[model samples]
Target: MQVKHGFIGFGNLAKAVYQGLKEEEEIEFAYFARSRKEADIPYYGRMEDLTAFADVIWLMVKPQDLSAVLEQLKTCDRAGKTIVSPAAGRNIAFIERYLGKEQLVVRIMPNLAMAYRKSVTAFATNQPENENATEIFGLLGKLGKAVQLEENGFDLFTAVFGSGPAFILSFIQIFKEKMQEFNLPGPLLDELLLELTQGTTLYFAQNQKKHSIEELIRNITSKGGTTQAGLDYFRTHEIGKHFEGILDAARKRSEEMSKNGD
Candidate 1:
């Protein structure tokens, strides 16, 4: 039997997940939009109508946009329907209060890397709700890694992994530009950087040899070597401390939003 799903917002993340699920023959999906024919998926003119066909409904709107959506949804009974939200700040209780006690709700935070099936997604839910738990896990399992975490941890995870990919990609691009500054050929630079980053990750995964990341760095930075010189430069420039502050600020903002973004 095909597992069908629907999305409330036809945004980039929604479209990406739709594409990923479409690749698998057993999952059928669609979305709701203002216009009926804007996207390839079947669109519903009204919010209540989407629940009719899909067992799972993904709420993919902005945090601020959620209130109006909820206002429309308030008139509908979502019993037996599983709703998954990817909004970074909203908690499951907030959703349940608005939707109803009988509704099955799960909150998730997924990064843009989900486009490539590399997302590290965190799901927070009342696990005692067996049906919703299974539905959420089964649906998200297709896109990438799904971790069940306490609600308190979701906000922090979003700051690190959900928003971390963009930060990492920006750093990668900065290095790529630095390679160009050295007059390296563009395609060769791209190829080298791609392999360089992937190889770094591969080293961790392939080596069953467990070592702390700091230990691994120390192992590479033997006394008076090139790695040591680079490490010294980074430390001297205070880049490591600056990054710690950056991540902390991001985490704080996520926490604040969760508290007030209703």
Candidate 2:
């Protein structure tokens, strides 16, 4: 049977998810948003119509917009439908308050890498054994690595995986800024950084099973070498701890949002 999937809001993240999953033969996609977007999928003018047409409904609106959207959803006949939400800081319990406890609600934290089908996604659901929820989890695996986690773990997961790409890119930006002395074109510098990151990722992938991350770093560092000097400075200044603070701040914000529900 073909599965109909509907998006409540067709923003960037929604677009990324559609791009990731549209090739699947069993799924049919459509959306209802404030404005129609350019896409090959069907666009519904009314939320009620979209809700009625879809078996799986993706609440792809912003976290702040979720409440208003759910209010509209409350009027829809949602029996037997699965609700999948990726809005950061919003938990299953928050959604359950609107949709009721019996609804199969899947909450996920997937990074922007979803567009490339390489997202590290965290999954949690109100109904773990529901066939629809399980299938959605399996579908997440096809997009990238997917792990079933506790709802409480989402805050940390959002900090690390959900917002991790921008954090990683910021680190790369530091390198780019440092290399500006060479006066290379910005695009060329970006390409070089991309190659460097790709090579590093390949090296890690090749040896990760045999070596710990520390071991990998040790293999690159030599006695009195440039890498060692940098390592010494990094340790001395507690750079790792500083980075952890960034993640902590993000997780704290998620917790606050969960509490405030705003």
Predicted model with the maximum lDDT: 2
**Alpha carbon RMSD to native, model 1:** 2.2
Error of 1 at 158 (Å): 0.6
Tens digits of per-residue lDDT for model 2, 1-262: 8999999999889899999998999999999998998988999999999999999999999999999999999999999999999999899988999999999999999987888899999999988888999999999998899999999899999999998999999999999999999999999999999999999999999999999999999999999999999999999999999999999999999999989988
Lowest lDDT 10-mer window, candidate 2?
108-117
Candidate 2's C-alpha runs over 4 A off are none
Instruction: Rate residue 165 of model 2 by lDDT.
Output: 93
lDDT of 1 by residue, 175-211 (tens): 8987776898889898998998998898776663788
Provide the clashing-pair count of each candidate structure.
0, 0
**What RMSD does each model have against the real structure?**
2.2, 0.8
Per-model TM-score versus the true fold: 0.90, 0.98
lDDT of all predictions, in order shown? 0.80, 0.95
Worst 10 residues of 1 by lDDT: 124-133
